[model samples]
Target: MEFFNNHTKLFTAAALLFIGLTIFVCIVPALKNQSENAPLPNAIALSDEAILGKAVYISNGCVACHTQQVRNVDMDKVWGSRPSIAADYAANYRTDFWRNTATVMGTERTGPDLTAIGQRQPSAEWHLPHLFNPRIVVKESVMPAYPWLFEITNKVKKGDVVVNVPVEFLHGQKGKVIATADALHLLAYLQSLKQTKLPEGIPEPNFLYKKSGDIGEKTAGGPKELDGKVLYITHCQTCHQSNGEGLKGAFPSLKGSKIVLDENAELFVNVIMNGYSGRVAEGYGVMPAVGTNSNLKPEEVAAIMNHEKTNWGNSAKKVTTEQVKKWMDAVKK
Candidate 1:
C-alpha cells in the first residue's frame, strides 16, 4: 500500500519496465533477425556509379513517387515477376544506425514500381528523354522534367553521350542535349534495380490472375478475339491518343500516317514488333516495341492494323492474321 502511494517511484518503475520491454521485445529481436538472415545468394552489391546515382535518386525525392517493393497480389504482377522478399534487400545498407537510409521500399506509388524497371525499360534512349521531359515521350505523363541534368551544347564532344530530344521539346535550343555524368549515374542506378531471382528452395511465382490464351492464339468472334479498341486503349492511347493524333513533337500522329495507309503492312508490323527510333525526323522520338512488350498476338496485330486503317477518316484494306504471321516469321529469319 505504501509503495503504491509513491507516485514518483511508481512512474520511475513503469518507465524502466517499458524501456526494458521495448529493448527485449523489439530491438533485440530485430537485431537478431538482421544478424541471422543472410543476403540472397544472388544479390549483387551496387556498383560505385549506381551507389552515387542512388544518392541522386534520394536527393531528388524520387522515392516519394516510386516504390521498390512488389507485394504478393494479383495487380502487382505488372510490376514484377513475384513478390519481393526481405532477403532481396539484405544487401542494402542503412545510411545510419538510427535512420533507415538505403532501403527505399516506398509506401506510395505515384509512379510505377521500379522493382524490375531495368529489365522492363532498359533502353537509355527511352529513359534519357523521359528524364529530360517526360511529356516528350509520354504525352500524358505528369512527371516533372529534370532538364538540369542535361546540357545543351552546339558542339558535342566525341565521347559525350547525347540525348535525342525532339525539336518541339528542345524549345529552339541550338545545340545537342548532352547527359551529364550525374544523369548517367542515375541511369545506372535505375538500371541496377532489377529483381533478383529467388534461390532454389523458394517457391515459384504464383500469379493470381491468369489469362487463357497464348501470345498469338485467339478465337474468332469469341471473347478472346482481339478487341482492337481495347488494345489501342491499353497500349497505344498513352502516346498516340484516343483520336489517333499523336503528340506533335514527341509521337507522330497515326490518324493519317503514310505508314498506316501504306498498301504493304511490312514496315508497320516491323515497327510494332521491333520498335522504331525516328531521330532523323525533326519532332519524333523513339517508339518502344509495343507488340513485344505486351506479348501481342498476330490476330491482335491484324486487328489493330485494321482499326487504324479505317478509323480517323482513313480508308485502307484490313490486315489479316496470316499476313502478320508471315511478316513475323520473316522478321525472325
Candidate 2:
C-alpha cells in the first residue's frame, strides 16, 4: 500500500505530460496555421447576407450533397487546379463559422467541388438562374428550388427599368421576384472559388512530334536543303509542341497525320495559310484561321506548312506559293 501510494504521483505526472504533448501536436499547429493563413478567408469575406446564405446552405442539407476540398492527384490531373491547402481552411480552423459549429467538412461529392466554383462558372447571370432553378441550366440537375427565398427586389415607378431576367429565373412557378442580397452574396462567395494556380512540384503535360520525309522534291532531283527545323521551332512550335502530341481537344497532331500524307499537297498549303476548322479525329477544340493573324505573310505560312509536312514522315508533295495564293483567293470569296 505504501509503494502504490508513492507511485501514484509519478503516474499522474506521466499522464499529464502525454495529454500536454498530444494537445501541442494537434492544436498548436492548427492555431499556428490559423495565424499564418487567416487572411485567405477574408479574401472572400462572408457578409451578413452571405452568412445567411451559408445558413441556408446548411439548413437545406447542401453539405450532404457537395464537398469543398479537391484531393491532390485527382484534382490536378483533370481539374486544372490542385486541392485545398491549410490556407483554404484558415477561417474554419480558427473561428466558429458554420463549418466549425456543424463539424460539416462534408465527405460526399454529389456535386463538384466548391473550392474552384468561381472560375467554373463566372457569369453572374448564370448563377442567378442556376440557384432559382438548376434544371434550366443543367438539364439533369436534381437540386430543389428555394422559391421562398424570392422576393420582389427592385421597383422603379418613374421609368420602367430594363431588367434582363435570366431564363432560369422563369422556373419559379409563381412569377415572384428574388432577394437580390441573397443572390449577390452567393455570387461573391462563388466568385471567390477561382483558384487557377496549379499544385506545387507538378509539371504540365507536353505534346508530340514526328520526323520529316525525303527532301528530293526540289528541281535538283536530289535531297534539297531547307532549314525546316529552325522555321518550325520559331513559328509553329509554341502551339503544336515540338513532339506534335497536341493539346487535348485543341491542337491537331502532325506526326503521321493523314493531312500531311495527302497527295493533294495544295490543300495542305491552303490550310496552313487560311486554317481549316471543321473537325479532325484528334484535335484541339477549334482551329484559328492563320490568315486572320494579319502579320503572317503568305510565304511564311507556306514555309511552316512545308516544314511540318516534310518533317513528319508524311512524304507528300511539297507546298508551292501558287497553291497558297489560290487558297487565299478562295478564302476571300
Candidate 3:
C-alpha cells in the first residue's frame, strides 16, 4: 500500500515490468530465430529485377488474393512439394527503409497458392497473356486483367519483349503485345517463388489428414493409382480446357487428335515434355515444356496420357508407366 501510494514507485514498477516482458517476449524470440533458421542451401537470392517485381507485386495488392505459404495439409500438397518451414522465408526481409518486409506470406487464398508456381508454370508465354487478360487463357477465370502493364505497338523494337497473346483478346488491334519492364519484373519475382528442396536425410514434414488409398503408381505389392485428372487440371487444363476442346486458333484440341490416337506415343510424349512450337503456322502459340518444368515422373505422364485418351469421348489405347518411361528416356537421349 505504501509503495502504491508513491507515484514514482508505482510508475517505475510498471515500466520495469513492461521492459522485462519486452526482452522475454519479443527480443528473446527474435534472437532465437536468428540461430534456428537459415535460408535453404539450394535457394538462390532474388535478382535485382525480382526485387523490383516484388515491389510491384506488393503495390498491386497481389498479397490480398495469393498466398505464399503452403500449409501442412493433404490438400496443399498440390501447391508445394512440402509444407513451408521458417527457413523458407528466412531471407525475406525489408528491402529498404521505406518499404515494409517482403515477407508477404498472406493468409487468404482467393487465387491458387504461389508457393511453387515457378515450377508448376514456368512459361513466360503463358504468364504474359494470362496477365494481359486471364480470360485470354482461362475462359471462366475471375481474375481481372492488368492491361496497363503492357504496350500495344506495331513496331516491335529489337530489345522489346513481346507478349504472345491470342489475336481475339487483342481487340483487333494491329500491334504486337509488348511486356513493359514492370511486367517482366513481376514475372521474375513470380518465377523466383519456387520452394527450395530440403536437405537430404532431413525428414520432410508429412501432410496431415491425408486420405487412405491415395493415388500413385502400382508397385510390387498393390496398385496405387495417380490421379490423372488432378494432374491435367493442374498443368494442362488452362490451355487445353477441361473438355479437351482447346481455345479456337490458340491451343490445339487434344480430343480425337492424331498424335493422341497414334499407337507410337512418340510425338505425344515429345510434345508434352519438350513442348510443341511446330503449331505456330497453325495459329497456335508455343506450348511450354510442362513435363520438364513440373518435373513430372513417368507414372504421372502415363496417368495424364490415359486421362486424355479416355476423356472427351476419345477411346484410345491406355499407355502404361513402363511404356511412358521408355519414350521419356529415349527423348532425353
Candidate 4:
C-alpha cells in the first residue's frame, strides 16, 4: 500500500509490468511463429526487376484496392485454389535494413483478390491496357487508370514493346502506346503473384460448391447454347470491344476481320485454341493463349465463333461444337 502511494514507484512498477507482458505476449509468440513458418528450401526469391515492381506496386497504393490474401471460405474459391496459410508468406522477407516491407496482405478488396492473378490473367496484352484504363477491358470496372506508366509515340521504334489500346480509349492520342520500363517491371511483379503451392495436409478448394458449374457443361439436347455475349464479356471483350471493333493498333477489329468471315473455321478455331503470335495483323501486340489459359471448352469456342461471326454485321453461319472438336483433334495430331 505504501509503495502504491508513491507515484514515482507506481509508475516504474507499471512500466515494468507492461514491458514484461509485451515481451511474453507479442515478441515471444512472433519469434516462435517465425521459426515454425520458416521458408521452404525450394521457395523462390524475387528477381531484381520483380523487387522493383513490388516497390512500384506498393508506391502506387495497389494494396488499397486489392487483397493479397485468400481467406478459408467457400466463396474465396474464385480467388485461389486454396486458402492462404502462414507458410505461403514465409518467403516474404526484408531485402535489407532500409526496406523491411514484404507480403502486403491487404485488408480491403475493392477489386478482386490478386493472390492468383498471375495464373488468372497472365497476359501482358491484357494487363497493359487494363492498367492504362480498366474500363477498356472491364467496362464495369472502377479501377483508376495508370496512364503515366505508358507513353504515346507516333513510331514504335524497333524493340519497343507496344501496348494495344483501342482508338476509343486513346483519348484522341494519335500515336502507338508503349509501356514504360516501370510498367514492364510492375507487370512482371503481377505475373509473379501466383500462389505458392502449399505443402500437403493444407485444406484445398472445395469443389463441391457448384457456383457456376464447369466451364462448359452440356444438356440433353447437345451442348446448351452458351451465352456468347456473356462469354465474350468475361474473356474476349477486354481486348476486342463489345461492338467487335478492337482497339485500332493494339487489337484487330473482329467486325470486318477476314478470319471471322472465312468460310472454313480452321483459322478461327486454331487462333482461339492455340493462340496467334506471328504478325497476323501488322503493328498488333501478341495475343496470349486465351483458349489454353482459360481452358475454354469446344462448345464455348463454337459459341464465341458464332457470336463474332453473326454479330457486328458479320452474317456468317454459326459454328458447331463438333466442328471445333474436330479442329482441336487435328491440331493435337
Best by TM-score: 3
lDDT of 1 by residue, 250-303 (tens): 567898888899989899998888877764366565676777655667888887
RMSD of each: 5.5, 14.7, 4.4, 4.5
Model 2, residue 126: distance off in Å is: 0.9
Rank by TM-score, highest first: 3, 4, 1, 2
Per-residue CA lDDT of model 3 for 261-291, tens digit only, reads 8889988999889887887887676786778
Q: Give one digit per residue, the lDDT tens place, for model 4 in 1-333.
A: 999899999999999999999999998997898899977555567788888999889889999999999887756766776778777788887757797667889989999888878866676777898999988877888999999999999988888888877788887879989999899999999988887665577555444444665444466876457877777876688778888887666677899788888979887888876777765457665775666656678878888888899998899887888989998777652
Q: Pairs clashing in candidate 4?
A: 164-250, 166-247
Estimate TM-scores for all models.
0.68, 0.45, 0.79, 0.74
TM-score of 4: 0.74
Ten-residue segment with the worst summed lDDT in candidate 3?
213-222
Candidate 2 overall Cα lDDT vs. reference? 0.55
What digit string (tens of lDDT, one per residue) describes model 2 on residues 163-264?
234444565533434545555666565655544343456463332232355222354764444456765664455345676654333456788788777766
Error of 3 at 36 (Å): 2.0
